[model samples]
Target: MSEGVVARLRQRLRHQADLGEVLAGGWTGLGPSELAVRPVYLEGSGTVPLGELFDLRGEPAGRIRFEGDLARADRLAAGLAEGEVIVEGSVGAQAGLGMAGGTLRIQGSAGPLAGAAGPAARRGMTGGELIIRGSAGAETGARMRRGLLAIGGQAEAYAGHAMIAGTILIFGDAGPDVGLWSKRGSVVALGAIEIPATYRYACTYRPAHLGLTLTRLRARYGLPVKKRHFAGRYHRYSGDLADLGKGEILEWTAE
Candidate 1:
């Protein structure tokens, strides 16, 4: 696929606008015409329509660029199964809820449960990558089954609650209870972090995969990826003994 569609936001939203179903599959087989015709809920009750929210144009090859501030836009990439979606600014809650596959990038901050499952849902972020260039609200990657999530800015409390399997990288300070109930996921902390008592210190060493992951985040998203973050020593802790105990927390150490 080629560069898909570009949707430029027209105005600040007074109600929720769901961009979930639109980019669900990452424009796999869809074209510009189909994409423009995709549905999106609008503010003030009844669905206003996606065309009303942004100026949609270009081909649909499974890649999309969203322009303008989407801070008020909720579910920007919910249930995505394929393609790549980029947001120029912040986004509202449940940004990538129940996302099965694909790549979703938010250039700015995000609200609560950024890549978590929806209400009554069993899993979150079943697959794919969700990148947050700025801060993320509470429970950023809760209940994720698989995929990668990188937060360039601070992450709020309970950032990776009950994650099944995947990786979450936080370049900035992480709040308390960052990975309380995670089952089997890796949380790499480049900034300050306090590991839960349930987690035991394993060792302080350089994890090769982390370097590759952080490097990608830096080069691709323009994150503040210093040399230290990639080559630095990290304090590895394994925990969530309450669950599978396969989860890990890598806290970067100054030494």
Candidate 2:
């Protein structure tokens, strides 16, 4: 494998920029010079070459790193079907919209709809891993079909709204209306959360899958997982009785 590509911010962004197209599968094979010319939609400015905003370096190797404050950058890794993407700082909305494969790791917080479906799309994050080491905004995994979404900090309301099938793990406080209209998905909350009224209480049990999943998060992602988490019991709630009623919310409880 070749050394991966690196794109460092050249200057402070005055406007929100859309970087969705910069890291698609085809662009991963291009050299730095060629990749630099990729289009980035800048607010008010219309469009500009990525090279004008970032200093591109390194070689293509199916991995890419973005270094700098990108809090105003949206869609940093949308539709990523392959390769790995690492963002060293915060990002704007739609960080992993419609991603089908690969991994998108964000070192800081993300805006609303971080791993949700696009405006025109029917599904969100069919496959892939979205790891947010910080808090996330509202509707973090809305309409998701399949994949793993891990949030290390607080999540706003409707964190898993309308989820079809997938897994969402929130390590901090989850906001209101979690798992509102989920069909068949799992929302695991390690912190305080209010179960939606549409869900019904299920028996408490130590799910075998929870232990394995927490182990992976600790070993691979370095998430803070204590022994209590692995051995704790979870309160399972089945809902959204308004929809398929197969979705569940797993709230961690001290045994």
Candidate 3:
């Protein structure tokens, strides 16, 4: 699989850049020139062409890769509905907000709300996969309606807060209030997790799903999957009973 278009940072951005809907639907068919003309909202400056920020290269294809320091670039892949998008380094807030389909892979930490909904929107990420290979900020998957968010490092507070449905798999320690008020969803914690009082201890067993999910992560995504992860027993806790009580937290226990 080739990296369709490579967008390299032209300069160190001082302000937050909102690449909203720039790589959404119909982007895979666009060339570098076409995609560069899309709108990107800057913090102090209003709307500006994407070409003004990044140097776009490569032919039109089904994937795109962004390089350089984008720590101040927010909404990098917002509203993405198809194809693949890759970020070489850390991203600012709302990395994959409201994404409906396709894959968004971040090789570094995410700011916040990786697959969560916007403030005004009721739903987030109807479908898709978001892979954050580093630590994530608060509310990474808050109000997520559907999709998969795999965090390779520690997640801050409210990692999966208020998730309606979907999966949030954290390979490292999870922060406080995880899965808080989540009606339905799965928060798979491979490390230590903060279980709220609203959650009730369920059982300790090996879930069948973890085996398959881990295999794919190791084979396909090349995540650091240990043999103990598949052989370990998990402590299941059903939580956010304060809401509908359908969500659960699967914390990997001793091997």
Highest lDDT against the true fold, candidate: 2
What's the lDDT for residue 24 in model 3? Answer: 69
**Predicted candidate 3 versus true structure: per-residue lDDT over 181-211, tens digit per residue:** 9999999999888899999999999999889
Instruction: Please tell me which predicted candidate would have the highest TM-score against the true structure.
Output: 3
> Could you tell me which 10 consecutive residues in candidate 2 have the lowest summed lDDT?
23-32
Candidate 1 accuracy as lDDT: 0.85
Give the per-residue lDDT of model 1 (tens digit) for 90-193: 99889989888888899889999988988899888988889998999999899998989999899999999888888999989999998888888999898899
Of 1 and 3, which scores higher on TM-score?
A: 3
Runs in model 2 lying further than 4 Å from the true structure: 1-3
Clashes in predicted model 1: 4
Clashes of each: 4, 0, 0
> What TM-score does structure 1 among the candidates reach?
0.93
Per-residue alpha-carbon lDDT of candidate 2 for residues 11-82, written as tens digits (9 for 90 to 100): 888899999988766666776899898889999998899999999899988888899999999998888888
Which parts of model 1 have CA positions greater than 4 angstroms off? none
- Residue 101 miss distance in model 3 (angstroms): 0.9
Of candidates 2 and 1, the better by lDDT: 2
